[model samples]
Target chain A: MIIKRTKSHIAEIFCNVLCVFVITVVSVNAQKLNDDFFSPKSRLSFGNYLFLEKDYLRASNEYKEFLKTDNNDTVRFKLSESFLRIGRYEEAANNFKSLFFSTSLTDEARLGLFKSLFFEKNFVRFRQYRLEENYTTEKFSHDIDRLNYISYFFDSEPLPDSSRLFSAFADLNRADIKKFYYMKKNPDTKNPVTAALLSAAIPGLGKIYTGEIGDGITSLITTGLLVFLSANNFRHDHNFRGWLFAGFAALAYGGNIYGSAASAQIYNAGVKFNFDNEVKLFFEKHNYFLPEFDFVNR
Target chain B: MKKLFYKYFLLIEIFVVSSLFPQDRLSIQFDYANKLFQTSQYFDAITEYKRLLFFDEAKKYSYKAYFQIGKCYKAGAKFDEAIKYFSTASINAANENEKLSVYFEIVRTNISRRTTSRALQILDEIEKENTNTFIRDSINYWRGWTYIFADDWKNAADAFSKIKSDHELKKLCEQVEKEKVSVTFTKAISYFLPGAGEVYSGNILSGSITFGWNLLFGYLTINSFAEERIFDGMVIGSLGWLRFYRGNIQSAEESAKQKNIAIANKILKYLQYEYKGAKP
Candidate 1:
């Protein structure tokens, strides 16, 4: 009777211990659930939190952090959108490109990507992408055309139908096409070898072609003065000084030719860039001057 | 009871450890920064000091560190950066003299670097505020040097004369007074000889160029004369040779006067301000 009584007491103690263990485990699991729900695992959740809170800087930071942690194209596309919302098109374009290949958001990303590039003034890349078969962004068609015209500024390579684009853009912008045609006709001004040869024939002819009359006059006068000094030195039998002045005059002459050619090229580039910017500003302000069609059949 | 006590102890221990680790790391950073400062690696030292200023917990030695940074920048001839740190040191200065000295140094550096206008403004303010006579005198002396640097010889002389019997400075003033030349003289000299005045002022290259051109024209004139080309000789000779000859003599006298004045002014600057010995 005593042995049976002891065994029942021990069994009762074991049951109580089991009950306490189960309670502790249940509480721990509940706490873990609360923590997991509060702390998001994916970047999209964090990005939304930042976007909704109107914390653009923090949103940008979170997006960057997300890129580090996960290479999710969807998240990257959203991140590009976030950059666009903040008016950071340069950063947005880079992030959009990060999602360009094999992402479900490729078409949407490409459209955003072109718009971003357009906004960043990267007309050359935008136009190049426009020519690609896979890169169709119907929404930004007018933008693509405008960028194609603007690409003349950024491209160092010779354009195929620059005159046509220049004329088209000039009509749109009310710019003087005569001046553009004048620059196109004068290839000698752009050629350093031709400018140098021309300058050697006459003191300031290269500078005149480069449209730097004041600098041309100054260069001519400076070189002339040095040559005169060299002649005077030779007359005085100062061979060393004569040679030195002659050398200086030669160098100055050469420098003027090279500088004129470079200046001409720089000026031409500037003209194109200015015209491009005018067109870009006009289009951007007028919603790329294209008809907005929101609904798509697909 | 024992398990509960042990659990609370463990919690306290973890909190303590977490707190201590960060503090210890911060102190180590501070020590490292201080070490960099002591080693004459001032550029790196500045970076370390900046980090400590941002992160240090106790915030002790900040003024000392800033003062050291200023000194280092001063040593490196980065006067603008030195001035910045010195101003920071002055703002946090515990000692009045230290603040005054920093202010003085800032003014001195500006004066040395030929920023006379700004230095003069600061000097005026310091003179008004500083009741200390020694500082006041030092400020006045430096003001005199500042005037000298700006080539304001008359004002420099007057400033130096205000100091109680600096014989050497007085002598410099006398020299400037004696050697002063008319502005028209310099113009006249250049007008007469293309570069003769510059030569008189120790510009050998300019003098030689002028002399060479004149000599060439002289030869041309003589050669033309020998060949019975009278018009050519007269034209070249009159147009070039005569002009350069008269120019050379006028430039020589004008430049000599200017050089004497410059020398006198420089002497005054050095004696009154730079020389730390007896005044005379």
Candidate 2:
């Protein structure tokens, strides 16, 4: 009977020890979760640090953790924004989609989604979303029209001439005219291989088509001079020198032909690139002339 | 016993969650790599970055590593290698900006190597693949430099003018175009006037050498004939005086050629090492 009583006493001691361990563990975890969610100022500070450092992925994660606890729409919006900053467009779109259903951030969410889709070049979905979502009315109507105009760049149809379709763009007062023309005309440039072949057939022709008249002329003249020199040297009975000059002439002639055509192709590609960037920037600045999601707590 | 179970579970949960959360290891590595890059220890920094890629937590750093490697090669003037690495980086980069940066490096490196045609080719590729206005403008600005290096001053001027801004590059290209002398014209001028090109090239010493030789030979030929020793005069005048006169003409031509080469080299050297402007 005395041994049984001693065993029971030891069991009680063990239970108490176990209880303390559990409580300590629980408190520590609870503290961490609480710290992650409840401390807005700290979380914001950390998020900002990551953002400034361009650690967008990490910033998004931190903001996500903050949002889990805080559940503040502003914080959620910012978390999605971090994803956008990192070019995690799909994730950003999904996050924005979540906010779209219920929150004062619905308009901002829709706009952010549109931007992400537009950047991802998902025209079909972007168009669908544009038609469905209601953008808040504001005084920057001209800016909105510009954004709408640039968005059409991602559309499937050919762009109309700025002089005809976008004469109004002239009055819009943006320094992106070159950018627009570059985008509009880029797709129409002849094929690179074909241009290269054309140039190969006749020096500088490719460059001329690409609007590099000076380069074309120089290439033709240089190649022609080399050819003349080589032929003259051969006629003078300097066979060794003639052959050497001929070889050099041939190389230069061939290379220039190749280069000219290649240049034309490159010029077109550059135009296309500039167009996209200009359009994206227009949207990034919210058309620069348009009002963005500037809801004053209405 | 139940309380003990809950407590242990909580501790385990906390430990598990903490472990699940990604840490600053990637960040720390990027910071170190950036620091190494800034210090110009590019090769060693590259190794550190490749280690990060091995971990492969995020594929983004891999692109950064490749881009830096290209840059390191470019810095060392190994442009062919740099272009290869840049192409590799562009192929694998996660985003448009990263890819564009890689393409930019390819153009820049090629231009630095005096492979203007290749740089222009890559620039076209960039233009086709990219859709950013700022990037396009920046690329065009560099394209102007490519034309300049290829000795197509007029095209360079046109490219810069098309930028439609107070872009310093446009003004610089215009300056280059205006200041440029036609190579053929310069060569022909030297052929016409023995020392004119030397004068144009600001080589008084060479000009004087040419002038002195021509004058001395002229006097020698004239005086030798006046002496009335027909055979002696013919031989001396034709072989000695005439030869020296011809040699002076050749020397003048040579000096002008050298001067032209020097000018071209000066422009190339500035572009290669000193000009604080877009290159490719």
Candidate 3:
């Protein structure tokens, strides 16, 4: 069938042929592009994607891969942040330290380094690092000072004056800081020696002073019963039973003194642990006073 | 005519390339997102899927991205966010089949979250909408799983039984039910006999101790009373015998609960790692 083809039909045929050719070319180019989707440049965005997803381990890995080709400050900061997020504090501290120069990220990195050390629960080491000017970006020194004051509460170091210790914190946090400071300086800690003496003089008074009311009452009742049993057996002329009861009474009295001293130490340890936990939780909830990432603005 | 043809052809080619280029890029992005999900990088997978949703101009794979994001959230144990994305997926689904798949995913997420009622409601909705036997059986299967997660073995068995007479899950549910000791029965036995509940709950050592304490103290109290030692009798009876007797009953109840928990956990562990069938 020889069909009559108009000029418009000829134009349409060329349009269809051109579309097919263009689609083929574009698809081939696209396939090539897709094959390199995991290249280093792509890995940077992929790492950021993982970071935002809170996939810290994989995000860090991606960032590390990207770092082999690119020494970007933002990526370095994110890599450190990823390590910090996953609780690899030592690695995080080292990563953050690499950014501790006169760059735009210096103060943040210094702050991040302190935070990393703080999370490691090595307050002593943190304090030592804080004192070194090499690690100190002076702009964030006040932040470090706050962390240092927080460190005193965590350790057995003698606390600085309340005014000096709380100088770094804003007024909003000063009250809580002061509470922790006073708790350290004049800790509601029982004196072990005094506790032992008190328990020796009165069977369970030491436990009561150590804030263990239930234990104090139990100790008193047990000791009183043993002593009474010994006296009763003696009055009744049962010498063997009386001796046995007296022996028990003596052991109970000695144990009460030792236990009271131990109780005082446990009380002090609990106070320290609770305070440290509160401080850590507070800082974590507030994101350590760091600047928010302005990804949208960028 | 040839010049005009070439101009029109050039215009069409540019349009075609521009249109097809972004689609290819988006498809690659989807593949990368799915790779993340496959590698168990769920949190990152969700982010990638959201990126696809952001640039999906024609909404070609928007619902698919939403469904995948829901799955990623569910894998991360973020049930609330999982449900949120799944709801969005169902809303954006292009057809009945896609919506149906999303609905099943929502049911599975609810079971994981132990939101049994919501899962049941969805299953009922599916049941009313379609009469396909396969769909009905699938709903019943998930219902059984929900009951299992809720620790209601009898209900689980009942749900499974509705699937088929000799189904493997039905058998498992029945076996779990048979092996479980009734907590109420143990508590009642302990109330009547001080250490009997502990022995019933398979705690021989504690049962012996509890019994021995009650016996020795009981004997001491009676002997003290017979010897006219009223104060000693009262103390021994009240503090020693009564305390141990009460403790025995309480411990018996606790042991029963622990036993039930252990049984449920054993089955749950098996299901998680070794069971060869559909799972929530």
Candidate 4:
């Protein structure tokens, strides 16, 4: 009878222990579910959604959260891509560089790094990094080469020989590229010194050369009228009036010379602006000849 | 033995059921996001709301999440983003009242953005769609607010008068209209008599100075011609008399405009800081 009581007591104890165990396990699981709102998995999914929506700032925040407890190549790449889209070049370059040594995305990462440098206008560093074959990939070498050539046009750097530069682009784009190259080499820009010299020889002539015909004519008329007034006053023995008119003439003539030089500078700036716009449009149409990442669609 | 078996089964069943009901989990997330919003952590709240939207597969929180997102953006003064999300919320609204609420939110956002024309257009559309007296009155109220934002005090008064003859906003608008100077009248008066507009706009000192200059230049020009100094007369008339005369008219118009702007700004400041009313 005592042994039977002992078995029953043990059974009761077992039930109580099992009840506590079940409650504890369920409570822990419920707590986890509550915290799942900001879990890494949730962050990654939200980050991907934001990235697809082109909300790069928020996407980068989410990706940063996800990366805290996990290591993911695609997520890292996407994080870097987000920085690039938002014009955060330094962060993007650093993130892309982290994947340079070993990964399925090594080439893509290298390319992304180069793009970050290029967009930041860090052309010198971009060229320096491009020379390291370990940092570049055979698959995208031609793309990097094209970017390098494009960088030359953006700055005062001398272009490579025509044969070397043209070979980097496709046959269809070569003609336009060659045109831009020549335009860069010998830009149709007016010389400011020459413009000043022209204005000195004939009042407002420099302005006319720099494409301000109305202003040039106005300047010429004002200076000529002031000089004529000065000469006529002097002829009439009105010495004070003559000196006043002569002083005004000298001021007008000096101002025209200065204005002509400034006009020439403005004209050169406009030519450069147009040329840069054309080059930018041409490359934008070509997508900068960069390879598309299929993963972005997924 | 059967009783013990039943107890274990119950424990396992509880676990399974708790895991299966993700709605409870979603409710917790919504509360978490709401807590963040209440604390004014708007940027973080937006991310949490977006997460809720992304995970809400049954779309049960679609309207609420989108509406909250709109509110968050509106709080940040991001009117364009607020309007975009409010539009999305309107699409997801489950009932007529819900849809109307979202539409009103968009109109309010547009009002705050100073897109008064669009706000008025939306209010017109809402009035046409709803014939209920309360809704119509609400539309007129918003229309009044829209006109107020546009600095059209007369139209604002007219809109508020539609709601009630003795509406507070209507009285305020009428008072503002009375206090405001007419730019066109000021310019016209200045054309006939130099600096009259500036005086009318309450710049007595500046108006007197401008008038004095005009009188002096006019006298010099006439005296030059009288003295048979044709060159002096021509120069004084073209450069001195004409310049001051034209300047007095411009200054008068500018003074009227500036006085009206000051009047509008006072009312706007009152509404923003002192007046106790529902604001956009």
TM-score of each: 0.43, 0.42, 0.72, 0.91
Question: Highest TM-score among the candidates is held by which one?
Answer: 4
Structure candidate 1, residue pairs in collision: B192-B247, B193-B247
Clashing pairs in 4: none
Error of 4 at A205 (Å): 2.1
lDDT ranking from best candidate downward: 4, 3, 2, 1
lDDT string, candidate 1, B1-280, tens digits: 3444455456545555544454454455556667887787877666556545544446665676677777678767788888888888888778778777777777777866678898899889988888777877777777877886777767777776777666455557667766665555655666655665666577678678777877777788899999997756886788778777676666666666667667765776776788775331
Model 4 clashing-pair count: 0
Tens-digit lDDT string for candidate 2 (B1-280): 4555565567656655554354345555667777888899876565555545544555857787778878877887878878877888888888777777777778778778988998898888888877778877877887887887776767877777767656665665566555545545645565666565566656778776776766676676677678865645675678676776566555556665675566656666776698786554
**Model 2 lDDT per residue over A13-128, tens place:** 77667657766775576556434422665555566555665656656666776776678777777777778777889998888888876687776676677667766777666656
Question: A49-107, model 4: which lDDT tens digit per residue?
Answer: 99998889999999999999999999999999999999999999999999887788998
**DockQ, model 4, C-alpha based:** 0.41
- The parts of candidate 4 lying over 4 Å away from their true place are A1-22, A237-240, B1-23
Whose DockQ is greatest here? 4
List of clashing residue pairs for candidate 3: none
Task: Give lDDT tens digits, candidate 3, residues B1-280.
Answer: 5776788777866776675665687797899899999999997787678667655779988899999999998999999999999999999999988988999999999999999889989988998997888888888898899889888888888888888988887888888888888888988988777788888888988888888888899899999999998967997899888898889888998998898888888888989999988777
* Candidate order by decreasing DockQ: 4, 3, 1, 2
Question: What's the residue-level lDDT of A124 in candidate 1?
Answer: 69
Q: Worst lDDT window (10 residues) for model 4 chain B?
A: B14-23
Give Cα distance to truth, residue B2, candidate 2, Å.
21
Interface RMSD of each: 13.0, 10.0, 5.8, 3.4
